[model samples]
Target: MLSESKKFRFAEDEEVTKKLFEEGDTDGDGLLTYEEALKAFSKYQRPFSREVFENYDTNHDGKLSQEEPETHSFRIINKYHFCGVFQFSNVVSLSHKQLRSISFFILAWQLLICDIMSVLVQFLLVIPQTFAGYSLYSHTFSYAIGSLDTLSYNGALMFALLLTINRLCIFLFPAIDQRVFGRPIIYGVVSLAWTLLFVFFIGLNATRCYKTFSVQGFYLHYENCENNSSSIGVIFQGIKDKWGRFSTYVMLGIYTLITIWLKFANRLHIKMNKTDGKQVRTNKKEIMFFVQSFIICITFLLESLMFDSIPRFKVYGQWRYAVNFTSNCITIFMFTVHSVVIFTFNSRIKEQLKEIFASKGKYYFASVTQTYPLQTTIVVRK
Candidate 1:
């Protein structure tokens, strides 16, 4: 029951309630019939069918009193509020744009560069070497071409590390994310990673090139590129193979550990009542990042395994050609697809792509439906 003082406080509300009741009482019988209530509600932009009105009647009375109207209003308000709560509770925000602190542009640029390099290596080197004669390039070009597979894997591993680090800063150490994980810092880290990769792998390749040229007085032979019969060549080959695989596995292991820890921490945060909607949303984004990382790692791993399984000189004739073609296709596909997937994960990039296509589509439609003015020449003879 509303007390007199409370009613006085809600006097304006009561007046509006009275107006609504009068509007619903179409026959002016001081009660709302089903049709009258439905019409009144529809005017207010609220859905109220006969069945809904019947539910509000409650006593099977065919008409609703003022008190019944107030009760129905309360029930409807509560029902919508309950639904809103459920929606909020189940919401999972996975938009990468929300993680703005992570430099998506930098990540995207790195992926793009790697993808372009993969394509160039495929067309300019891999295909020509496999199908056309392999005699066009000297030993240096051959060595660089062979090393591209390693470079692509390293590039992907670097990207995965960068993403993992960004997520760690955002979710675990958010207080310092702005200062510590700024764009400049991210840029420096990525630059340093590439520089180190070049110095180590490219430098090693250069050393091998020098050794082959100095000893054999010619470019490294495809038949015995490693010069594996010699002890020093065997050591160098062992180092090259072991280092490439070791670095990739180490990075993957670290990424896996970080992902597991993040999952555990997120669950614990929820259990401890420390998680809010924003935190939950961030967790969802992190999970999506983890999924993307997993895909990248798996694809790169498969490509690397395929490359290692096929020996350039050991296999003969059609089988060697087939293996080379298959491996090159798989490697190029993985790099290209990985870059595309990374771009799609960013909401801003996705929106831009959508807008570009939409504009083009509209233009195409207009061109197809265009009407041109017909020229009519009036005869001067008239």
Candidate 2:
């Protein structure tokens, strides 16, 4: 039942627990109100839903009294690794035509790989170093972790844009969709984009842009040029900081357009099979995939705001443990949710998962579904 939770409470310590309660208990009161707890959690970037808050406020009271902070378990990596790893594995083994025929799955597969690599490093090294204050780093560790951080964060934004564009073409501009996104073209687009992104960020490591980890702040910071705003670190950080909010707004605008297009699509005269008189429209399954992408995009929007709202609480000398736990919880959930949404929304992937596990890993049976996505064509009188 508890397999999914990454967090565990620290050992019982009244001294420390009382300090936590007092820290949360603003206005010099002994008990912490719901607002006090929420404000305190926001400072740490902790996930603070009403459900989570209610769980902490045991004893039927709406206040907290010195509860121990929660931290990551050793097995936390399993959550992301299993879902993402196996998703890729089945895709490769089965050679699923659903993914092979569509550009959306191509982008999603790349993003999944990025998430797996990012979470692997975070759970194994970053969590230990940040929370337990472990110094498990070689001289090369800085560049390596920094490269991963670059790939995951920056790579995700780019891939998400690709996915959004693919959806727009499928749902809104199907007339030029095939010419623009034929099998060879889409494959080339995603591969080249990822290659350039990888080469550019990893290439940065050759320069003076160094990423140093801070146990106090529990994140990596670039020391490429502290004083110069024109430094590599400063320049890169500025782009990342701005891209997230801008992309969110853009995606929202595009999604609105897509929604309107789909609503009025019946007004357009398009046909996949004019002989049989079948109506041409975006596939229902494709809409589900679009929904999944929407969830992830909205999540990134929230995550960006969380970071802005919760500046590093590095000054908490005695409350360092709570700070570590609360700050990392948000990150833990953020990466894990992508895979959860993927499996939950995509029926094809979910079915593939069931098949792989159902027969002890034998998966050669072909699906009876169509071998390819319907080539969207607009057949109307000029």
Candidate 3:
């Protein structure tokens, strides 16, 4: 009775309806409520209404439950965003490398995961809510995301320290490194890093509080209002900041000393033996490692400085929003640049990326050629 176009449209609508129903039934209890249906359909272009929901409740029940002859698909598709894909690729590339110590790789993985979380928080929470024409603000959400950003910054610093330490050990005391920084010891250090971060998070919750304030009836703003503004809190914050800066400087000094030592060591080796291919290769690797570490350390320090300089006093109106947005944008940009530097300086990552791209290109070219066969003309003499 229906035309072809009408039949196709009906099929498409049925498919979308089934998808919405499955997504709304989060508990898989074979039922959907008003609230669940609203949340599910709100993300889509359709306007969900109470009447529409009631229509789906064919049995006259308050809830929309699965009906007879309706088959539900329970399969869910998991996909990665840009940051997630990059994080996964970075981890995979690092894993393929044959390294004497995995401490650097482990720390790098932590940093990458932190950056991805930071990006996700901004894109999913901040951007969407800002653009959705919402006046309400949540201080807790802001603080949580800020804390995650700080954790990621600290992770970068720790990574730089780890790289410097590993290089120092290899160049200065190779024998002791094996026993001192064994797999178990390295694992313990990584665990300690995460444990300390967790403790710091707890401390932030206990010491600091965030509050929302109105700005001249123009807009609502959220800012940190330290609940414990006592000398103890100040001292604790100061100690934390000082420790981070001190550790970074110490690591940089150690790296410098190692560089000087390597320079002299190379000179002596050259004098003793004119040519050693293995030594040359090792030197090149060390050079690349040093460059990468240096750049990461600088970026980490700059980010720390930026956060430290952010005014604690309440900012109002567009200025407050502008400051916050700019700072977040800069932080994300720095994180991205750091990742690119790591990939650029590491030869192993370069080779892995090359292979990946090459294979993908070959597959794409093959598919295109197959889809559109090349036309060849045959010329015959008459």
Candidate 4:
């Protein structure tokens, strides 16, 4: 289906492609040999296997090459593939340095989403509900907010843990990067998590929930009580004591340990890569990721620890409540900003941002160039 002028041609850097081709074809048979295959596999951060290489090389020319064995429309973002917005006709045209940068961005973006979810759930939904009665208008409002808070906090924490585990996996096993955390699995996990959250929290509330009503122009609240339920405020306090203090603290502890381990691992990674000057550029990224996690962990721990203290000392009626809310909001704000820090401080992300801008610039220049025309004018001189 190729036109005369629209033939498949190598549009990438020719020199780079030629060198890779030459190096890959080590057997002097005009094709890649098993040894060359091993080298290619090693370069891609995967273990070399002769059997796999032979199976992949369909030409039966006793040498391997970078031709597609299967006819597929979708590009695979596998170990041997880059699957970028741009394309190269040959492997040699691919820049390993740029590929690594993209890898870093992918990792950072995953972590950023988890942190954003954590902030949204913890600060906006959960923490506000911790107070005795932020939404005391009706039972429907109270139950709705309480259920949302529970779901958000727990779901966010679980998602954060998964993201941390995913980071560790990608860092250790670079070969199966796309396969390990592919789009299908990502979508499925997100859906399952949300579903579990709904069922878990909603089911719990369905059994031991309370309702508020107004009796004789006075507000009345009852929780699983048969006689004069409004007389006892113990139900609400019990709910708070169990879910607000104990459960939240448990989550905070787990997340803190995970964050600490992540920080240590990142530091150790930097130490190991001391000789690689390229890693120096990642220092800012490392610092930003570490600091953001540290802040979130500390904020969470502090907030969890202080949940009980705020109620014990009822120093200010309304003013104290305002200060408490403001402090909680600030912590949430830090967490939200933490989600975006990776994009801001990461060099790889910055590079991609520049590439996007440069691409737009090129488009505008091309448009202008096409519109303008060169003309020759005759100058009459005496």
Best by TM-score: 2
Worst 10 residues of 3 by lDDT: 69-78
* Candidate 3: C-alpha lDDT: 0.57
Candidate 4: list runs displaced more than 4 Å.
1-146, 164-192, 208-288, 316-319, 331-335, 340-343, 347-382
Cα lDDT tens digits, model 4, 149-193, are 455454545444444444444445445646655555555655676
Listed in order, each prediction's TM-score against the native is: 0.54, 0.63, 0.60, 0.40
lDDT of 1 by residue, 1-382 (tens): 1111111110125675466667778787777877777777677775345544543453457777765311111112222323332222221122234443556445645655565554555455544432321134665666667566456555765665565556556656766666655767776777887897676556445446321111101111223434444665565556655654654565566566767777696676555356688867866776677666656556656655665666544643233334443654565556555545665565765565567679999887566545432211222233
Error of 3 at 190 (Å): 1.3
Query: Which structure is stronger by TM-score: 1 or 4?
Result: 1
Find the 10 residues in a row with the least total lDDT in model 2. 1-10
Q: lDDT: which candidate is best?
A: 2
Model 2 stretches astray by more than 4 angstroms = 1-98, 128-132, 225-237, 264-282, 312-327, 361-382
**Colliding pairs, model 2:** none
Query: Looking at model 1, which ten-residue stretch has the lowest summed lDDT?
Result: 2-11
| Runs in model 3 lying further than 4 Å from the true structure | 1-102, 129-137, 209-225, 229-236, 264-275, 306-330, 365-382
> Is candidate 1 or 4 superior in lDDT?
1
Candidate 4 weakest lDDT stretch, 10 residues: 71-80
What are the RMSDs of all candidates, in order? 32.7, 14.1, 15.7, 31.3
